[model samples]
Target: MAQNAHGGSRPGVQPVALAAAGILLLVGVLGFVPGITTDYAAMRFAGRHSEAMLLGLFQVSVLLNILHLSSGLVGLALARRIAGARAFLAVGGALYLGLWLYGFFIHRGSVANFIPVNDADTWLHLAIGFGMLACGLLISGQVGTGGRLDTPIDRP
Candidate 1:
């Protein structure tokens, strides 16, 4: 397979990043919906003051949803280039790691939980952190494998 716009195979971070971006974008938009985000009226601009929760599970706020939306946009923009894809993954990993840290230290019901993260969101952040890092690291090496490893038929 020829290199795509990102100078890598079509199965690289381009697809995964795009998917992630889309999902995050949808989640961000949905967070603003009344029923989807319970107690929408109480949604604070920032801080743990917001009682709104996305899907009535994960804590959320206006600032948090907007941040998610912006991150998704960035991810979409970077999905077309190998370098940009790698950068996006790396940055995403760092952001998730930061979120993990924030989740660990912030008071769940206090103003510290500006992101409105909860246990579920914390774990999800951890997963995103590791997954993004792995994607960037693992894919960097496979970009030019030349299909040699998969050519069993040519191993006469």
Candidate 2:
């Protein structure tokens, strides 16, 4: 496997992906906590009316937290392989971007707002989409051009 300019032996993307997953999981869990998520009782499954916020900044709900956690896990799991990581980032980014679009179109107070995203969340999702995709695509692997895979072609 190729080594970075540094002496590390593993690909850089895996660590970042795993870290993102961990952070997402933490955020999801925290959103459920009363103190952490202020106005716990007012939290709803979805919609703009939900008074709960993650870090008192981003709007959140039970469904939204679950989705965030799940997406993070998927990103970490997919990071085990280069191709999988790439696909996860690309697809995940697209999904988030789509979610941002959905947030824009959906009426915040309507029943259709399942994710409970607000204006802040819509912007955040857009950032996540671009960031995740960029990280996956830009991170160099531990091995040669083909990534960390140990194949005959990569063993120069």
Per-residue alpha-carbon lDDT of model 2 for 1-156, expressed as tens digits? Answer: 346557655546666666666776787888899888988898998766788987788889888988988988888788777677777777787888899899889898888887788888899888888877787777665444554545698777
For model 1, how does the per-residue alpha-carbon lDDT over 1-156 read when each residue is reduced to its tens digit? 337556765565567777777877898899899998898998988887788888988788888899889988998999878678778877887887888888988878885666778887788788878888777655642444344233478676
RMSD to truth, every model: 6.1, 4.3
The TM-score, computed over Cα atoms with residue i paired to residue i, of candidate 1 is 0.79
The Cα error of candidate 1 at residue 11, in Å, is 1.9
Candidate 2: residue 32 Cα off by (Å): 1.0
For each candidate, what is the lDDT? 0.78, 0.78
Score candidate 2 by lDDT.
Answer: 0.78
